[model samples]
Target: MIRTKSFLSLLLLTALLSLQLTTRAEDGYRLWQRYDQLPSKNHLKQYRQSLGEVMVQGSSPTLTVVKEELQTALGGLLGQPVTITENSRKKEILVAGTPASSALIKGLNLEADLQKVGKEGYVLVSKKAGGKKYTVIAANTDLGVLYGSFHLLRLLQTQQDISNLQVSNSPKVQHRILNHWDNLDRTVERGYAGFSLWDWHKLPQYIDQRYLDYARANASIGINGTVLTNVNANSLVLTPDYLRKVKALADTFRPYGIRVYLTARFSSPIEIGKLKTADPLNPEVIAWWKNKVDEIYRYIPDFGGFLVKANSEGQPGPQNYNRSHADGANLLAQALAPKGGIVMWRAFVYDNNVPEDRAKQAYTEFKPLDGTFKQNVMVQVKNGAIDFQPREPFHPLFGAMPKTPLMMEFQITQEYLGQGTNLAYLAPMFKETLAADTYANGKGSTVAKVIDGSLHNYSLTGMAGVSNIGNDRNWTSHPFGQANWYAFGRLAWDHSLTSEEIAEEWIKMTFSHDPGFVAQVKNMMMGSRETVVNYMTPLGLHHIMGWDHHYGPGPWIKDKPRADWTSVYYHRATEKGIGFDRTKTGSNALAQYAPDIQAQWGNPATCPEEFLLWFHHLPWDYKTKSGRTLWNELCYRYSGGVDSVRAMQKTWNTQQGKVDKERFKQVQMLLTMQEQDAKMWRDACLLYFQTFSKRPIPQELEKPANTLEYYMSLDPKFVPGI
Candidate 1:
């Protein structure tokens, strides 16, 4: 009898081990949609009871996807297959559909609630009707029902109480899109995650599973559109062969309510159409574009319109023909207008010949042509006037353009924020820019309101994120990089959501529900962006990274092709001081802003220390608010950044047992690289800047192990994402 009992126990142990092996590994491919089995049996029981029967009343492609997603999520979360029935007399019945598609939902008299939530909005309610408990996800359109389904799953995933739920939600911006800087050759510009997600070579024939997954992920976060190609476009993408490939992607994404867009190469008419000139005013050029756009719509009926990057960094544009930006945008806008498409004209233009401040060029060029753009044209403005730097003042054109709709373009890829290896939660950086008071109208005028069309009173609005997605298994190379993508979608859906709230939701869904682990990681992520700015470009210093690749420190970078392209041009370091002077006595770029903003940032004493050096050339001996000399403060800030990274490492170390071993170790290794890189940045920058400061490194701070010559001499070869 004893021997028999021992054998039974061994068999039970073997069964448990086999079950563990069969469960999915935490590889991060599922992202925040991991509907892992509930840990608490009591909670599972409650959810199973509440979600007893699902009666979906729509059969459209989008609603079909919604039903499948619901089944998958419910089965995984509750550890039981949910019953889908045509007629459910069950007390707790989950019903989902649009008012037009469902008689039951239409009869429920939810017109007031549905009216409050727009066409793309959803209303989720739990009510008792005639002694029967019912949970309803109702919307005015099929797309809204899809969004509502995701929200319902999110409530369960985040362990929110849904018993008395009455949720009404809508995206603040009309167009929430991801701009993939993916090339035809499968390389991604400024992308740190692996190769491009779209396999253009094998596309239109072999549909990779990643395509569907990518669409699902975007749809879950209320992203409605995707720009398939890079803004620095290739004319070949518009060719017949590539249009077929784009069509395949569009077909796959259509069911998820995601419309695919392309980057319109301004020279496509000359390159592909064999036109004499690609001028916007040229009749042949105009006809060529119109025919090309018509061909694209033939393949992709719901195609989103063009994202044009012209006359910047040598790309062709109307400027080449001595025409205004409005002329170029209007050319494309006229073609897409008939098909209900819109043009996203980039405002990232700067000219070496013009000889204006690089920071002031976009505002100068765009502010003049504000009301000239066509109704369907949106001037896509980068978050900052310059490139996606660590920290920058909100783009001057955000509030300056009231007549033209301006869309916010944020970079989700970590171009300057340590690329693939560092952990930098960018929601804080994004929030900082959105919350900045533009003062275009009055005190409360903010960048968020401007982009959302509330302040400007525009009918069309959009928020575009330069995508960080790639072929990497985890989507983003750095594990925490996924949070950046998630945060951008959440902010695009609702600009009012706090960074901390988004971080918490992401942490819970992506990693763990353990309060201790969540708290520690949240603290680490919240402070990461500031830490990067402190080490890289503290005191408003910007654009000092490696010359071409922008990999690391290069404060001594000078003698480039253009004066504005060099770090010395922006920093202006000399025996007197270090920093660019953009004041009235200097570049006078502050004059672009409203008088209130100019007054706030004009004086060095009143200017936020964070932006002091950005606008003023300060002396090394200048007194700082920290009661330290400018030189000493610089030393402290750089060192403090390194110290903060070490703190992140320490915090992550405590989460070993709480987090999955695979992701925890991956983050650990990345954190180690981040620490080394931080030190490299600190040592190389301070050593180079010491030449201009002529001041000793504060005795309290660590000294550089390598000389300035050694730091400058180092040339890293084959840097990724160049």
Candidate 2:
């Protein structure tokens, strides 16, 4: 009998090992939709008791998705079958509804309040109804209920209390979206993750479970919308066949409060519509857009809006017709307004006709047309005036436009900040911009306040992040990159969340709830962004990337198609000195801000050290707080960034067994890559700058082991996204 028992145990062990191996082989493409069984814990038992049964009050493809998602997640967490019953019991019952479906919900004052909430807004409450204890998730529409269901599941999965829950949260902005710069051919522009998630050829018919999982993850974090195609707009996504495919994704995402948005090809009237011109003001062009909007609405009634990138990077727009950006935006806004959609016109534009100071161009163009834009139009501005750098001051446009609603555009993809190789947590980056005091109206005019439309009484407001998501096992190629997407959604919903809080929450959800592990990882995540900025573009240095790929270092790049496109334009690293001169002596761009801000930033001595080089030109011998000259300070920052990554490696190494083996190993390998990359950045930058400063390597710092020529020769062909 003992021999037989031992053989049975060995057989069971072998079976478990095989299952584990199979699971590990699968990349984390499912993201948080991993419906793996939760550990047997006291919290799981309590949650299961509170959520004994579910009652769904809607029927659609989206509704089916919600029910299946809830069933899968609940089954995994509870380790038991959760029956769905129509009748309410004295015990706890999960109730989901649209305002039209639930009479009890319709009777509540919530119905009037629900009108204020968008179709995607939802409320979760634990209350006694009809003499029975219930956890009810009600929304203005079925999509809202689907979102509520995900919210409830997230709280439960993250080990938050579900009993007596009274959560009524709606997105402050109408369109909280993810802009995927994914090409139809599967190359993602500035995307660090593997390949594009949307396989265009297989899309409409072969609805991958990954699509449903993507919706679940986004809805869990309060993301209400998604823009599927690249902002460098493609005409094909507008075709009837692609629209059908998009409708498939829209159907999958609808119940989860996510509406599918498309990157509008302004020249679609010419390219796709075969018109003579794509002028927004032309009667034919206007009619074409109206018909297109009608076509989209017919397929997906909850279609969010259009994300337009025009007259920037050779893309077509109203400027082609000699009309202003506001003219371009207003035309699209008019087409969509009848269907209750919005037009998010990008504010990132600059060309030879524009002024030399690229940072100030957006403000120069958009601020003048404050009230000119239609009510349904939002000017989407990058966090900084320039592209998403490692560190950037909040865009001046945030405070400048009170009448026109401006949406904050953050890049979740680490375009300039080490791509997917470096484990930089961008929660701090987002928090830095959001918490910045815009001082538009008065003392406390933070960017957050402006974005939520509280400071300005504008009706339309929002936030969008260019997605880093891809066909990776963990969704984001780098595990830490997931935090950026999570942080964007959290901040979009409630811009009040601190970086520390966000890091802690993400660490707990993504890794472990163990306080020791959370604390250690959170510390690394919290400081990671600053470290990258220090190493790469410290003290307001910007846009010094390789010529084409924008990877590693290319501070020596001077000859490109456009002078400004090259790194040399911004760095100004000649024999005399380095750093852009945007002061009274140069572009005088500082004058655009309020006099108080200009006064503060105008002078190098008084200017915040963070933006010192951004505004003022100073001698290399300029004194800093560290008692080192400007040159010395630059070296120290670069060196510090390198050291910080090494320290992060040590911190992560200590977390070996605390996290899942596969994830821990993956992070360890990435950290090794980051350390190597950080060193390369430090060496290449210092070597290049040495030509300008004519200064020896500081005594305390290690000299570059090789020549600048050697560093330059180590060029990587086929740099990921490039």
Candidate 3:
């Protein structure tokens, strides 16, 4: 009896401790939604005085999100109770709206101009109204008001002065989506975070607070769309049972202006509708898709349309029906057109039968069908021609597809780059790809302009990132991974925002507002992506991760089914030299680029060192402008990456007291892990590549402690998304 009582006491204590630790994990699943206490007491007090009472004059599902979010965020930041009053005659009040719902806003002459701002745009102004000075956040619709509410809170959270603020904001791109490669069974493809947040089994019955929180987080960043299932799809999602579950999530996210998208299995007509041939040109197949889409829209009126992965990597597509990609994409676009939906057709296609370079496949496949796609169809191209490698030249399709709308697809999940274990800030990489000159129209044709439709004059434009989100307490598995999510949103909303600005904003919102802390952390964040690229894929080397798992080095990967699929095919390092030659003399892939870019990159001496190995195959003895031979420069770059990571570690250590203990420690541990992995990458790559160079390691750098073979053998078998 005595022992039983002691055991019960111990169990209770353990549960309480677990709960406390969970509350303090600082893992980042809450993302920017942390709503942490404001660092400036004066600013906090000032904001509280001006925005203490949130007078929500309207009630809608979206307004509910706004009110609840305001109350929760304000209470956390102010450390005081905040009330949502029905009456707004009080001195200090926050009036939010649509004119129909908010009389005070209507009286302010906002309704006349609200129509111009549209449903998702907002106008926030500080003015004198009805004998009292008040801050007003108004919009044409409740969704816009909700967005405005979050925008106002964001400014306050970052400790910015709102005394004379007059801000009008709308997304540059209409669709900002996070593509979840989640299976119905809750397994996420290439996901390093926890299990899928969409608990399909329990959802549509029990609406988890996690779902609400997910909507809030996405809304805060202006990510207005989410595709909840894997692009490598299953047809069952079109069934009535799954449609009910999808509607529940759509209803929850509606107020936040987030629409749910689903992956449409091309073979669904055959599988679910009992049709023999699921051909895009087939009248029966086309008719079946129309009916299915009609059913989906009936359930989810604001349903974001289908994302299709056809005839690629074993999934069924247009090729099975002897139809072009346009045929497959347009059929669905036609179906969803009446409902005002759009089709996002994936351009990630390759086949074992095609003996051409894997990097050339996507460009070849989509180049011919440039103007063939319907107006509502967007051809989604991966950031690189190949899969999401650590470093890849911007896809050739970015420049080649001038007549069609092409959406940029970036992977935020770190599938090939270190997953959740390695600390890699991806903003620099994103900026690099976006800023690359595609040179389609002229010298200034950049990938950013292409996706934003400035270069091609496309009406339908978007940017999609494969999400890293899951059920982890911090959202993304690694704490720093949140920065990628934040960066993607900032870039998606305004591609013009620099990486430095994005990093600083994220640092202030996620960590500390102290000037020194922000400055120091921003430097680390800016350099982190390049550091990973250098250690992992320096000098334009690409796709060398272990087969399947893709965790660590696999420079020796060969003997795969397809020659192009092997890592050895890309690097092409032998006794003579390295790099795949894509120049006019070689594959003539250089012809795809505008002549000016071709002139700059075609010549080895003038080509940027960052992409030298991508376009040119230089001899080991070739002298670089750095006064180092090609081989020595490669070794130096690999070592430099490791050194940069160490510098990031030192900088983070100095920031210990400035950030919360739990979060600081979490980042420190991740950085420490990064150091070890960076070294592993530096050593293994140099040692393996050195065998072909037959050169000595730079004397100043430390040599690998282990043999090349030993490093190859010491593999972590548990790497996810293999």
Candidate 4:
């Protein structure tokens, strides 16, 4: 009897190991769609009870994808193959589709709920008919049903209670997109992961499996559009050969409800059309653009539109022909109008020769041009007027352009937030700018409301996130960087989501379902953004990173060809004080804002200290909110940032067995590198700035082990993402 029992045990052990090998989701390639078995058998029982015989009652490409995805997801989560059923009367039957496609759902009264959710939105409800209980995912369109399927899968993946689910959701903005700054040669600008995902050399004929998976991940998160080329426009992409490649990608993404857009070179008429002048108002340029747009629609019937970066950083534009920005935007808008497309005109324009405050330049140029742009043109404004700094006040353009639709442009690449290696959860940072009171109309005018079109009542709405994706196996270089991508998509769909809630969901889906592990990691992620800001650019300090690559601390950077190109120009640290004064007494950049903003932010006492130094050059003896001198406060913030990173390391170290061994060691090593980098930021900045203040490092805090000359002499070579 004992020998027979031993044989049975050995058979069971071997079978379990084989099953685990094929089903492991250790690599982040699966991302948050991981459908690994429920951690708790009790939870599994609950989910299985709520989700029984699957019946996606539709027949189309999108509905086909929905069926396959749900099959895979449900099979993985339940540790069993899910069977398709034809019966709607079966208790716990999961019926999903548009009411027109599913007779079971048509019999139910969901028109009011379905009407509330627009064409892209969905409704999930648990209903009863006689004695049979049914769970239905109903939507107005096929894409909405697909989105509903993903949302239901997410609820299961995150272990949410779905027994009594009654949810209706719609996207807050019309266009949620990813702007890939990828070039034709597979090079990505400001991309920290690896090379570009678009294999241009082998495209149009050889469709990579990664493309379908990319569309799957995006569509799962409610992202509807993608800009394929770099904002530094490439004319070759408009050529016939490249349009074929764009069409291949467009076809692959169409079923997933993703539309592809390209960047239009303002000088395309000269570069590809064989014309002498590429003026926006010129008849030759106008005809060339119209013909080109018509050709694009032929290749991709659902081609989204164009994103232009003209007259910014030496790019060609209407300014080259002595025309206005509106002229440049309207030219393309007219061409795309018939195709139901729009032009996303970037507001990142600046000139080194123009003697203007770098932070005030966008508002200065765009505020005057309100209502000049066509209805199909959207002014894409970055979150801040200057750049994607660690911390910046909301861009003044958000509230300034009420007549014309203003779209929010946020950078998710982490160029200034420690590039690739640092673990910076950016959802909090994104929420900060969105929730800021722009005061464009009155007190409660938020940047979120402006972009969502509720405050401004604009006809069009959208938000663009400069993508952090690349060919890296994990998409983003850091494992945690995936959270930023997920968070951006979630918030782009609904800005009302809390940072904490997003972090919790991401943590649960990405790392572990263990209660203790989830809570600890979620807390660590919640504080990561502030921790980065503290060590890198504490207390309103902006654009102090090293020149060119923007990697480490460089408070002493000066003597560049352009004033704004040097850290010294922004920080203005001197013998008596440190900071840039943008008030009436200084550059008067504060006058660009509404009077109420001018009154609150202009005064040092009333101004939020997060933006205190951004608008004022304060003295070393100035008292801070903590009753410490300005110098002491700087020391405190810098030290606190370093300490916070250490805490993050400790928290992650304790979660050793909670996740896969590969990602566990990966995060562990990354955290160690981050801690070292955080120390470097604290030491380098304090040492460099101490020369101006002539103040001793606070006694209770750690002091720099090296001199300022040591930091200045050290040069890092071959940095990624130039």
Q: Give the per-residue lDDT digits (tens) of candidate 4, residues 1-722.
A: 99999999999999989666644547688778878787778779977876757887777899988888888889899887887755655667788889888888888889999999999999999998767777789999999999999999888888778888899999999999999999998988889999999998998899999999999999988999999989998899999999999999999999999999999999999999999999999998899999999999999999999999999988999999999999999999999999999999999988998897888888888888999999999999999988999999888888998899999999999999988899999999999999998888899999999999999899999999999999999999899999999999999999999999898888888778788998899899999999999998887999999888899888889998889889998988998999899999899888877788899999999999999999999999899999999999999999999999999999998987667778888889999999888888999999989889999998889888788898898778878778
Instruction: For model 4, name the residue pairs that clash.
Output: none
In lDDT terms, how accurate is model 3? Answer: 0.86
How many backbone clashes does every candidate have?
Answer: 0, 4, 6, 0
Clashing pairs in 1: none
lDDT (C-alpha) at residue 244 in model 2:
91
Highest lDDT, which number?
1
Off by over 4 Å in 1: 1-25
For residues 300-386, write the lDDT of model 3, one tens digit per residue. Answer: 999999999999999998889798999999999999999999999999999989876777888888999999999999999999888
Candidate 4 deviant stretches above 4 angstroms: 1-25, 85-89
Clashes of 1: 0
Against the reference, the lDDT scores of all candidates come to 0.92, 0.83, 0.86, 0.91
Q: Rank the candidates by TM-score, best first.
A: 1, 4, 3, 2
**Of candidates 4 and 3, the better by lDDT:** 4
- TM-score quality measure for candidate 1: 0.98
